[model samples]
Target chain A: MTDRQLKIIEIVKQSGPITSEQIATLLSVTRATLRPDLAILTMSGILDARPKVGYFYVGIDENNLIAKKLRSKKVEDLMSLPVVVGEEATVYDTIVTIFLEDTGSVFVTDGGFLTGVVSRKDLLKNAIGGIDINKIPVGIIMTRRPNIVMAFPDENISDVARKIIEHEVDSVPVVEHVKREDGKEGYKILGKISKINIARFFVELAGE
Target chain B: MTDRQLKIIEIVKQSGPITSEQIATLLSVTRATLRPDLAILTMSGILDARPKVGYFYVGIDENNLIAKKLRSKKVEDLMSLPVVVGEEATVYDTIVTIFLEDTGSVFVTDGGFLTGVVSRKDLLKNAIGGIDINKIPVGIIMTRRPNIVMAFPDENISDVARKIIEHEVDSVPVVEHVKREDGKEGYKILGKISKINIARFFVELAGE
Candidate 1:
């Protein structure tokens, strides 16, 4: 901040809700002289300008600043390539895919549209239940569509992080609505956001 | 920040390496009048003061401010109660306990000291690999001690979070060094830090 800007903040802090004209008079300068400084102060969120009332002191809040910056980050900026499988793939194949990709869950698609989600937990339960892993298709035991928590490319990282926590799921597929060949609405998988992503983001935030 | 502080920053930014007396002279104020403001600016990292020279403009870095706040959090402040089981517990029983507690992994202890960690992935892998889970003790399948990633109460959250991501593990046990009956070094599990905790913390930071 400049000395003039600092002086302007001091003026506002003491007599906030004071007009720009009054501040100019107190500083022995014209309103035009204080224009740029006032602009910088208010623009930086150090002061609030109310019509007919004047600029009010809105000192920098570090917590709110952090929150604002975090919210500014969108899902598209941090999402990773989604691990996906076809609905017709066997449960055993899905499990193999999961291990190969090292993902917590895999999205199931039918004709290239999301149909279900199968997590490690789900596969474990089925694996222990005496089910024929090689015979049963993943579509038979997966958490079917409309039940899966999903994300969009433009959604805020904070919002999606909340979904991951609230849903108690390791990850969610970032999807887009599309019309299937059967003329039904379906979601096309784009990316995935998981706890790992959030953790990495936390590391990134701290490192930066 | 106060107006005088802002003014001080401006003066330093424009004519830095200029002494305090010179700044006081330019502002038509006494050195005493600028002392508190200068102190605040320097303390907040907005200015760097040299012994012989005047204050230099360090400026406020929002990213660093966020990083400092994040690093300020310690593991003990955010860790959750660890889900533990004895080494004698069968894999089937451990799996049941995991479902009952809704945890991703369970710490295995022997004589009340951490011995190993068994994650859902390990159990699932064993479950589908034709093992008799009911007869196999979790100790046989767990990632044994000395190979486990562990945390301490005083470790920084950023450092632990980095460990979680780099190690590719779901969580790590917060342990304390202890002497066993035979005088062998052992770790007593105190808590666990997981992606869930980190995600929750991310929410808390963004919310606050």
Candidate 2:
């Protein structure tokens, strides 16, 4: 904004709804000279104009700008590397992978296709259920496909965020359809969009 | 944006750097009448004006607007009710409470003062460690005070988001300093700021 434009705002703020003629008089400029500045101020929602009352200081619509920026972002830009294990892997091994990867959950794949997901809570339930975690396959305790919430690369970050909240899961696997070696079609794990990613994104959005 | 303002933008976007006189000719209005609209378009950052040249379509600075809105929010406005348990509660019972409440972790309080936090991962390790979960207190395996990351009511959500990402914790207990029954000052659990809250907030911001 120019110095004169800012001054116009100040004058309007202090003595509005004051007429443009009075403002031009204070600035020693004709109404024609101040018309453009007034137009900018009112058009940007920084001031309100009435037929007889003149201009009133009105703030910008911050939420609209925020929403616009948020909507422009896609899930692919924010997802993190997914931790994966085979469906046949023992529950003990899967837990070890979770610790090694420092992830809240691990995706389970069969023939390199996503089949299920196992979380800390699920493993804890089984671990305390007196079962032999080393003897049973992780697939036995996992939340299987068709039930697992999934995300695509082009999906909106906001939509995936809603999925994470509604499903109450720490993360959702970003997947894409592919053909396995045996010619069966299934989703292949591409990445994982988790709360950590969302938190980090939030920090970045605020920081920027 | 007004119809004339949008029409002005379209003209600038298609034929800019076109002069105000040319734009006025295209719109069938006098140059003086188009001055305010051009001023509004340029001031709001929708168009760029260059002296001795003409206007150019310059999109809004979305990040700045998003950052402003994100920074305006405080943690207290987005936090969820924290699940709390006494230090004497059994690990098994704590796990039960976690399942019942569907929370990722529970705050452990001693004499109404926060003493520790026990997460699902913590319980999972102990549950599989061959310890008697039914006989041991949850405090025995919890992350104790002074080591726990915490949040206050007035903290910026973005700062807490950084803490959550840096600490790799699903949530942090929001606390307030209070005098216990024994006259000792300690933090009292108030609520929890979790990734879910962040995710939900993100959805709302985008939705709005």
Candidate 3:
């Protein structure tokens, strides 16, 4: 909605059962110009109007509005591609890929199948342990599948945000179920939902 | 200010030169109770008033309001303790320090004098190079002084935010000038400003 429409919603919310004439006067706009805004609001269930009683508020709870917006939004609307590396890739090469992508984590995959995930913390842990990064395969140190937190396209974005907070993880891979040639069920990585993404979304949609 | 006061500001911003009678009625409060809120707005220069014309909006440029808030705020108001490690400490120990603290970077200090900064990326680079983390001092691999992005207590938080964004680093160490025992000027580490801090500040202050 445009700023003007948002303003109209605020007006009706603060003082419902107010006549269009009164609202128009308060906004310094003509009734004809406000007609469209009123219609859109009424049609969208944000407002209710009567011939004699005029406009009344019928909007969602304003206090939890941001939370509601987040919950209603699907993950697919905001998911982005995940940084990935082959399972056979050495820890040294994985480090290069991570810095090159400028991400906190990368997915370890084997023949396009989801396998494991490695994060900056994981790499730091390995580095601190006096391990040979060049010789060790990243898959050996990665958080294996079944332990990795993930999300589906149809899941609520708010749930994804909760997962990030609860797990204290940077990102969760977006995945989908796939059937292997042998008929066993497996998952395929599609995208990721990062803390940065959620933070940015909250900033953009919460207030102005 | 309370959310109610914020709402009052929004009301005046959208439809300024509006009468107190209208605002009080819309907010479902008495004009007597709104007196304090009005006074605060007028005192803050966020609103201007006239005897007959009512209240008028006289605030910062709306487009740059958020940026202005961040710029005008002191780093001291938002800083958190810097995660630190001794300069003589091994890269292996630095890795342990980083993971234990759950921070992406740590300050390398020698006798309380600001020396260098070691980040996850730095450790990863060392790891990839097949260096002996347990033997190499972090000071040897750290981003030396004059290369590290820093903030002072008097510096703008917005400037710190910009540094993080421009440099693509996780955090900036907050530092201040101090006199050494030998009478030379030196820098002392105070705290840090991170991306999460900025994001939380934005959420708390904007549009609430």
Highest TM-score against the true fold, candidate: 2
Question: Best candidate, DockQ-wise?
Answer: 2
DockQ of each: 0.31, 0.65, 0.07
* CA error at residue B21 for candidate 3, angstroms: 26
Candidate 3 CAPRI level: incorrect
Cα lDDT tens digits for candidate 1, B1-208: 6677667777888999789999999889999998877766654457778888767987666786689789989999999999999999999999999899999999999988899999999998998888899999999999997899999999999999999998899999999998876988778899999999999999988893
Q: Put down candidate 1 lDDT per residue, A170-190, tens digits, no spaces.
A: 999999998866788878899
Model 1: pairs clashing at backbone N, Cα or C within 3 Å = A2-B10, A3-B7, A3-B10, A6-B6, A6-B7, A10-B3
- Ranking 1 against 3 by DockQ, winner: 1
lDDT of 3 by residue, A1-208 (tens): 5567777877887898889999999999999999988876665456889989989988633434343344667889888889999999988788888888989899988878889999988886775566888799998999998999999999987777767656778789999999888877777998998766655554444223
Query: lDDT at A37 for candidate 2?
Result: 84
Local error of candidate 1 at residue A35 (angstroms): 26
Q: For model 2, how does the per-residue alpha-carbon lDDT over A150-177 read when each residue is reduced to its tens digit?
A: 9999998888888888888889999999
User: Per-residue lDDT for B105 in model 2?
Assistant: 90
Q: What is candidate 3's local distance difference test score? A: 0.78
lDDT of 3 by residue, B1-208 (tens): 4577678878998988899999999999999999977876665456789998899888533333333334567889989889998889998888778878888789988888889998888887786576887899999999998898889999877666666756778788999989977887768999998766665554444222
Indicate which candidate wins on lDDT.
Answer: 1
| lDDT values for all models | 0.89, 0.88, 0.78
> TM-score rank, highest first?
2, 1, 3
